[model samples]
Target: MQAVTFQAPGEVRVEERPEPDLLARDDAIVNVDATGVCGSDLHIYHGRVAIEPGFTLGHEFVGTVVAAGDGVTQVTEGDRVLGCYCSACGNCFFCRRGDFHQCDDGRVFGHGKTLGSLQGAQAERVLVPHANLTLRRVPEEMSDDAALFAGDVMGTGWHAVDQAGVRAGEAVAVLGLGPVGLCAVQAAKAAGAATIVGIDSVEDRLEAAEAFGARPVHLMEDEPRAAVKDATDGRGVDAGIDAVGHPDALELACRLTRKAGTVAAIGVYAERVQIHMGVVWIKALTLKSGQANVIGHVDRVLAMMAGGLLDPTPLVTHHMRLADAPEAYAVYDRREALKIVMTP
Candidate 1:
């Protein structure tokens, strides 16, 4: 099998590797059909998130189940499947409470030994741990391209809106317009937000957000704070989402949310960074931040995707063969593509 491997900072390669087999009673092996190149992959590509050399490197995947262990009951061999980026042991304390993202035995695929030594799906095959909890069958009507987002990007986007408690007739602001941010815009609108503000610097992303029913605001050219205030009649939006992992976007989200409103940081924050506690304290804001519970939200996200209430098809800007993964990674790292789907 040919898999994408992480070499070092600014490097990735497509190399022949051994195929995976079911190693646990709850495991399932998937014949990967399509896998996404995500922003997280970029972190490892840039050496920002350290991983061992030659480790398989991708998480978002849509494929067919080639085999399943006896313990896997939710799905079976021959079923079309999509895998969550991470898996959780259903018997854990957090899993018992529906907080599967925090399950005591959670393991993330393709993140090297630190995350779980699990090989990624950006290849001919992948091993899905806790199969019953990690893999969801893709509806027959959903395309491989569309179903690909259910496990990760779209799930994370929906988590932002869910965490913010977006309600009908409420105003919401989503900072950043990457694939996650664009998906956040759609999620906010689908969640019944009357006004959705999307902030980004790129013109194409701003245009795309507008097409998704958001009032796109250029982060540098336009004053996001003023725009949010004006849209809310002087008060800030009811909820603000930080879709960009940068600290500046997080700060802006906090500032754009009204008093007693919620600020949901759906972006990745791995290290300690300075935050303005005074702003949060003075405004009486409810701040929530962490990795998205993508496993927990996959079902709902899939439902929305199947219902056409949330379509991320447009975000698929590039479709390339798995053999071209090195170029795909380069394009993605260069910020030239929104979402790249690699077919094995």
Candidate 2:
């Protein structure tokens, strides 16, 4: 099977790789139908997130189950399915507490050895461990493009709004209009936010956010803090979602949120970054930060997608053959595409 492999910073190669097989009782083998090139994948591509060279590199995918072990009853062979990016041990401490994302024995697909050595779904086939919790049956009416988001990007957006407790008639601001940011805007709207602000420096992204029913705020030309204040009648927004994994964005989220409001940082943060502790302390803001628990939230995301309350199909700006993954990565790296779906 041909799979996308990371060779060095800013480089991905499509090369023949061995197909994956079930190695655990809870595992299933999936014949990938479509997969996505996500922002997190870009981190590994840039070597900002270290991974072994030649590691299979992709996570978001919708596929058909080719085979399943006896323990995998959530989905069956030949079932159309979409999988969460990470696999968790159902008996782990965090898993018992419903924090599957923090499972001590969790393994993230396509993230290299450090993340579990699990080969990615970018290939012709992928081994899905803990299939009972990691894979969900795709809805009959849901397009592959939409189903692709249920496991990752869309789930993250929903998590941001869920964690922030964005209530109906409340105002909220989302920082960084990337795929996740745009999805966060949609989630906020679905959650009944009366005023949703989408902040970004990219004109196209801002436009996209506007289409998702958010008022776009340019990060450079417009004062986000002022915009939030004005929109919220000088009290700042009820909640702020930082979809950009940067110190600046985080700081802005804190500043734009009303005192006693919640801020959900759904972006990927790596190293130690400076924060204005005084502001957080003074405002008594509720800060929630971490990766999304897609496994926990996938069902909710799927329901929203099925009900037409949330649609991410528009977010998919490009589609390419799996053979063209290298070109796809280059296009995504240049910021030419929002979501790139690849078929095997």
Instruction: Identify the leading candidate in terms of lDDT.
Output: 2
Root-mean-square deviation of Cα positions for candidate 1 versus the true structure, in angstroms: 0.8
Model 1, 1-344: lDDT tens digits are 99999998998999999988789999999999999999999999989999999999999999999999999999999999999999999997899999988988888989999887888889899999999999999999999999999999999999999999999999999999999999999999999999999999999999999999999899989999899988999999999999987889988998999999999998899888877999999999998888889988999999999999999999999999999998999999889999999998
* Global Cα lDDT for candidate 1: 0.93
**TM-score per model over all chains:** 0.99, 0.99
Q: Native-vs-model 2 lDDT?
A: 0.94
lDDT of all predictions: 0.93, 0.94
Off by over 4 Å in 2: none
CA error at residue 296 for candidate 1, angstroms: 1.1
Report how far off residue 293 is in candidate 1 (Å): 0.9
Instruction: Please provide the root mean square deviation of candidate 2 (C-alpha atoms, Å).
Output: 0.7
